[model samples]
Structure formats: C-alpha cells, structure tokens
Target: MSHSIAIIGASGYTGAELIRLLATHPSFEIKALAANSKAGQSLGAVFPHLRHLDLPDLVTWEEIDFDAIDLCFCALPHKTSQEVISKLPKTVKIVDLSADFRLRDPEDYRKWYGNAHGATEMQEEAVYGLTEFYREAIAEARLVAGTGCNAATGQYILRPLIERDLIDLDEIILDLQCGVSGAGRSLKENLLHAELSEGTNAYAVGGTHRHLGEFDQEFSALAGRPVEIQFTPHLGPFNRGILATAYVRGEAEAVLEALQQAYAEEPFVVVLPMGETPSTHHVRGSNFVHIGVVADRRPGRVIVVAALDNLCKGSSGQALQNANLMLGVDETAGLMLAPCFP
Candidate 1:
C-alpha cells in the first residue's frame, strides 16, 4: 500500500530535495504540493533542476485536502510550521523540517525563536527526528521534528561518545562549516552572488547559534545532567554539505570504538576506518553520513569529524528515514542511491 504524501512548502530548497528523493521512493506517492506564493505553477517552473521528474503543480496550503493525505512533510519556515501544522488533521503524520518543534520546552523555543510556541500541546508530542538517536520514538510518533543541520552534524560525532561516557564532558568543542543552501531558498542581501560567491565567514559566534539548544537538550539528557559545548558555525561558499570537526579529550581508540559500536547497525551512518577522516565531497547528494576519528598529537585528545549533505542526510533524507519507520516501510528502501562523486 503506497502512502499518499503532501509537501506543505514545496518551492524551497529542502522541499525540492524532498521531491527529488521521493520521486523514486517505492512506498510513498507525492499527491499534493503547497506553495502559497508559487500556487498554480508547475514544480518544474519553480525548480528547473527537478524538471526531469513528474510531480504535482504547486497549490496553496488551503487547497490541499488533508483528509486524503496519509503523511505530510511540513517544510515551512520557523514559527510558520507550528501555525500551519496546528490546523492540520490529527490523523495526518507530520515530519516538520523547521525549528518550530525541535525544542521541547516552550520557553526554550521562545528563547531561541523570540516568541511563544503557538501550539504547545502538539509540541509536547513531537519526537525529535534525529533518526539514529530517536528511532523507536520516531517510529511511534504522529509528529516528528527534524534537527538543525548543524545540530545533526555535531550530534552525530559527539552523541555516541557522550552516551558511552568516554569523553570529557566540559571540554567538548564543535567547529562546523555548512553550505549556503542550509540558509534556505529565501532572498537576502548577504546571500547574493556579489557578497557570498568569493568568500566565506563565520556567524552566530560565542555559543550563540540556535542549534545549541538542541545540543543542550540532547547531550544533557544523555549525560543525565546539564552539558554545554562551545559551538560555532561557519558559512562556506559551497552549495551543499556540512563538515563538523569536534575536539575532545578522550582516548582515540575508545572514541573510535564508541562511534563504531553505536552506528554499527545503522543503515545511514557510516563509521569510516580508524585514522581515516571523511570529506563532505565523499557523501554529497546522498542520504548517508560519513564519520571519521583520529588521534590528536597530544595525549588524551582526539578529533572526530563527520560529513553529510546538509540537504539530504541532514534534512530531507533524515525526514524520509523517519517517515519510513513511522509508516512501517523498510528503512533503507528508497535511500540506496550512492553518493555523487566528482
């Protein structure tokens, strides 16, 4: 039985990415696409790169018949997703690709987003959609919230070590570099070709990045106490991908063993051989995360690196992976496409 799916914000980068991957998905069918601004236009018109696939024309959210849809991917902007999702049918399983529902505490949401959560009841039920960490919960959830791309990258490298108690809790530092597409498909002066084309710079410095809320929530839970890490994100000139380098004090062999043991059974996470670090190019355009660990010259220090396509494994791919679990389909069914190579 094929599930009928709807994409609520179908004109954006992540929305297009979802369509690209789901075009070949075996268990789900794209039944509707909603884009308020681009309504009545064909998906090909909005995203020329996706012209190769057959998909529905863009429609306004009000035009979609939620009664006929089994699952919905809410790809709307922050603060907007909660408002949109609040009005959807209770029976519709939703995977939100926004910052709205990722934080569990409403206060935290307001702290990071600067406003109260419009839908607190639903927020309480939303399972954080870090597929590897929250698989069982996601499988049983009616609403799943996708992680921040930067948050996902950092967690993939540190979560396992933190869980195994193999690293210094207070000494973890995450330095991440992400492609511009992670900013979304909106217009901005800084994102223009003239400003972002020839150079790269870091933003949200000094432990101020929003994704830190996620790091605090998840890492704290794993350690059974409050855990904070120094996190900084850099904007790279590239189009897509995220490379996170984590510095910590731990035995290199133990860190390697912890990561390998944690992701050994995971379909989407690949723990590369010891002493071999991953590159963003290696996992480009695929629903895969490549992680590598190596020893630092200084004893009791190690560097853990993780690479993933910010749009794919970090967002849409992760969403689909959770959707598969929620919908009772094979987790790896439509995600077998190999990463693109240069």
Candidate 2:
C-alpha cells in the first residue's frame, strides 16, 4: 500500500526536510531524488545530517523514470519550478514548494517574481496549497502550489478574522521575523554567520514582499475586495521558525473567539489563551503553528501572533499535508511528530 515518491531539487533544505518527515510515513516511499547540481552524488555527500537513511542517490531530473513515481515534490527555485513541473506526467501528483504557481494571475506572477510564467496552461488547475482553507480543492488537485512561509504565518492569524469580519482589513500590520532557512540552502553573503548572526534587519518593506501577492489574493477573495495588510519580514538570527506579530483593529475577545472557533478542529494550528503570545521556539522543528491573541490598551485594537518552523509547518509540512490529501491518504500522516523543544 506504500506509494512511490520522487523529490525534484532534493539537494535543498526543503528536500532534506521532506525526507526526514516521510521517513516515518507508513505509505510513502522515497524512490528518487533529483538535484542536477549534485546529481550522482549520494544524499550523504550533500547533507551529512541525512546520511543515516537508505535513500536514493541524487540524480538529474532527466535521469528519473517518472513512471515509477506517484507524487513529486518540486522544491526547485521559483523561476524554474514551472518549467520543470510542466514536463511531469499526468499520472503523478505534484506539491510545488515555490512561488511559481501561488499567484493565480500570470500578470501577478510576473509582477512579483519578475518573469513571465512558463507553465501558463497549468495555472488554472494548480490549487493554492494553504491546506486549512483550500482543503477540498487540494484533496482533488493534481498540482498544489505551496504558499510562502511568511505568507502562511500571516494568514493563519488573519484569514478567519477577515472571514468573520472580526477585524478591520485595511488596518492590519504584520511584522514577521523568520530564520535563515526560509532563504533556502543557497550561498549568499548576507546569510553568512558573521554577517547575519546577532543582528536583525527588515527586508521587503512596504508592500513589496512577494508573499503579499498571496495575501492580496486570498484575503481579498475572502473580503470580496482588495485587502492589503502592512507586512514586513525580518531575517532573525536563528536557523528555523517564523514569528509574526500582527496589529489589528478589532475587539480582542471577538478575535480570540473567531480564531478559536476556526481552528478548534485543526490538528496543527494551536490557538493560545488570551494574552499569551507564542514564541518561535515553542513550535520549532515541528509541523505545528501556535497562534495567540490579546487586546491592546486602546479600545477596538488587538494584537495577534503566530509561530512555526519555517521549514516545517510553513513549507514542507504543508506540502506533505497537501500530498496526503491528493493521494487520498490520512491528512495527518507523517505530520504528527511533536515539536522539538529544549
């Protein structure tokens, strides 16, 4: 009853994450790993932490016999994801961990990502992969597009509030701090330990963060108008987790009730008691998202916070969740492992 799986772009952090999570999954088999740059190299050579597993040796995408795979996790970079996924066979389902297909409109994709979408034909069918809101669509989708890690954290706090009219959509502000892993396993001068450690600075200020495209799309769709929240993301001095603090205009009690009611049945989302905000460390290394809400000293104002491992709940964890639904397996499979705490 096990399903064969392939990970395209398996040399990246997210690819290794998928391997770690699926290692314990009862129904998924890691059949192939495609990382052209590291092709023919064993996984251990690229990621020593994963050296203990008996996983497939790294290979180029063209080398994989796609027919043997039932699902493919496209962890490729944004511009390249659509191009690679376009060639995948119809028999295989895909969970793409990139910004390529998250935006439904080709124009929006180009605007945010600075390139024309390569797989325009697939846009209409690629479901947005925020599992909680798009569960039904993802369950039947052949392709699911994963949301940005920062975007996911913000939505976990804002979506239900928007839906219930519990907050002023136009007045929302999100200040997020995320670990380096969200930048992927690429070599960049800024990500260097000496340069990045012991310091925190904001990037994608104003309405410029690409994930805003997702927020504008989903929140606007929910509110039936363009809802643009003030979002600012910071590179935290850590290896994992994202903590997003949002300021909003609403009754604290109502916002709390709405969030609790929305996620009361959700397995991964935890709504903390009023006045208690979540820290990134609380949910580190797990597929859990901790959300908290509190009233500000000013009336009609509230503060909301959310935390999760950028690599886990925000990315691969979500991809795996959607894959489970697409494959008709238990949604929580391979995702139930508890958070790694001190």
Clashing pairs in 2: none
lDDT (CA) per prediction: 0.94, 0.93
Runs of candidate 2 exceeding 4 Å displacement? none
**Candidate 1 lDDT over residue span 164-277, tens digit each:** 999999999999999999999999999998899889999999978999999999999999999999998999999999999999999999999998899999988999998999
What TM-score does prediction 2 earn? Answer: 0.99
lDDT, model 1: 0.94
Residue 300 lDDT in candidate 2: 95
lDDT of 1 at 332: 80
What's the TM for model 1? 0.99
How much is 255 displaced in model 2, in angstroms? Answer: 0.2
Model 1 error, position 1 (Å): 1.2
Off-target runs (Cα >4 Å) in candidate 1 are none
Worst 10 residues of 1 by lDDT: 47-56
